[model samples]
Target: MSDTIQPPFSILFVDDDQMSRHHFARAVSDDYRVHLAQGADEAMVLLKELGPEIAVLVTDFRMPGRDGGHLLREVAQAYPQIVRILVTAYADKDMLLQTFNTGDLFRIIEKPLRMDSVREVLKQAVARYAERETRQQRLLAMDETLAFLAHELNTPLAAISLFARSVENDVAQEYDPQRQREIGAAATSMLNNAQYCLTLISSFWATVHKSGGQQPASGSGVREVRAARLLATLLDSYPFAGLQREWIDVDVHGDFVVHAMPNCVALVLSSLMSNALRALDGCPAPSLCIEVISEPEPEIRLRDNGPGIAPEVKARLLLDPVTTHAGQGGHGMGMIFCNRIMQSFGGGLRIESTLGEGTTVTMRFPGSRGRIRDADGEQASVTRTV
Candidate 1:
């Protein structure tokens, strides 16, 4: 079996002077993948193309057109993961101070650069990059594990709540002995499932915490959930009432099944749907369409005819918690939470929007392998049985 390996750390050296760029690249070529850019414009292009792979950026401060500080600021906003270093021949104290204050500049190299000093700075930059990456990966893994745990615990709790309600209803009314027995059996099953899930969660945390905080394997408590039924449950219980509820539409392409913990999928959909509803608050003739496509992949597309996201908001939408509707109590963590859940499922979430037009949020899940009956007694499509 082939093992997955990370590519070598890369550095992008940007300088208007050809000799400086060439010398820098040559010095680090042996230890890193060195990329050369002549100016800030070229550096921007390279940054776009190799943002994720390039770990460090070294740019000359006194370049024509946009300066190194400009490039560093851009990288800080768009690709904060990239470590930035500034090189300058003339050491202007005020300029250096401003650069440090405004940009994510890691270090500054003085004029007539010493090869040894350059090498040391490059080594430190690589070390810092690796440290940040490791910390981020650990946090992300922990976030995923926690989301899975919450979903696992929530699903069984929901089942218990549902079964408890059934028992309450049966006892409240004049019930047949057969109906009472059936309700009792369902309650027993719910208790058993809850107990099993609680045990699994306990063991999951113990293993994860003991194993140096590594991510726990997925599908530990995964169960098949029907797409159509899931959507129906969400829509029926949606906070919207009366005519407002009529604005939402759900289209399921045949019977589709998603092999995941039911609550995890529901949590993702709920977050997306809630955002859509909020976006449509003041729109004229607002409508939300949810389409579930089974073949090719199990994907859900939630499209809304509402005011699209602003450019500034769209740029950092999933990167951090940001809210466009701060006045209306928007926490801005909904999409981030949803993104984490999808990633934990080995899936992804995508959002596309045109200002003044609308926004479409696509959620792709692991494809189904076979067929299974949903809670509504309807068959759903899947690729295989887990």
Candidate 2:
């Protein structure tokens, strides 16, 4: 007992019965720091008051005002960082009928409470919370490091443009006016691209990392951006080498706001472009048309006139890594990453292709009424969570 280390975060116990709250808190207070809430409403108040200090939520199913099931669902959306547990008289039937989403509730406790079993569950729940916090810290560190590198690179890139301009001026009349203009434009484009990438990295970092005296949105990294605005930025800053830019056409008929990490969106586009370029390498004509469509749903579609994906390869593309360009350093994680980002927004991705025709990839986004909040800043309604 003396050797047992207290958890970094506290446990919250919510029950309608006064005697029950005291008994439960009294039993576990030695090993774990516990907060008592008489009902669901009180628990919510405590959550806002304590914030990040509370990690595990244990509430009785039959509570006054609001039931524990509702509390769990609300917490899962608002503060996904908190691990939730339900205390119910009838565990099996109540859990199955009430909470079909296993993702929300962590564990179900049966009454009358056995102190030993309850203690064990609390211990495991604390362990889970500790692991989640550790992972978040690691991810935040990596993201901040990348942001720092991007910020540091911006200065050197601007200096390079200035140096190039000076070198060109020193050798004036060696090139015609039109040639000089072209050289200046190219240098400016290079600097602009770096600056754009830095902006995206900074934006993503700010969204994911807690900043600007803003309360943390646990387990989410996405922010809202208009599809048209994001696409323009992506295309303009994209390092389109050689004649690749000429092969691409973008048409924005309708725009929709999508929730996602901007840099991740750019990465997804880069992956798709790389795939299309390789597929159309030896073809007589290659074209990639990107369109923002508003119809049955808000969507972004990418159509490429290249050798279409084979039936076998297409079938396995979303499920697993199916690639023909293994020799060229391709691991086939592009579509996988794209699928994850789409799903995080409560949207989906579809790939359609035919032999000798082309491939069309559609990115379906959550409409105005719906937004799925996945871990890494997907926004939703719950205001109280760690």
Clashes of 2: 6
Best by TM-score: 1
lDDT of 1 at 261: 44
Worst 10 residues of 1 by lDDT: 377-386
Instruction: Provide the lDDT at 33 for model 1.
Output: 81
Clash count list over all predictions: 9, 6
* All candidates: CA RMSD (Å): 15.4, 15.6
Residue pairs clashing, model 2: 219-375, 219-376, 220-376, 220-377, 221-376, 221-377
1-386, model 1: which lDDT tens digit per residue? 22433346789989999998788777667677889999999988988888888999988899899998898898899999889998888768999999998996899988788989988998899889988876675566456646645654554566677777777766768768888788877876576556645554555555456655643334656345688888887676544533557788888886577655454576578667767877897787999999988766667899999999988888788778897755433456666767776665556677889899999998867554334333353554422211
Clashing pairs in 1: 255-381, 368-382, 368-383, 369-382, 369-383, 369-384, 370-382, 370-383, 370-384
Candidate 1: global Cα-lDDT? 0.73
Task: Report the C-alpha lDDT of model 2 over 1-386, residue by residue, as the tens digit.
Answer: 44677765898999999989999988998898899998878888999998699989998888878888888887787789998888888747746466747437778778899999998998898888887875664454344334333433443355556656666676656778887787776676566546545655565565456443232344557455777887887777555656778888889888876544445455555556556766877778989999987644577888998989999999988789777765433556557656655554456567999989999987766666554333344555322111
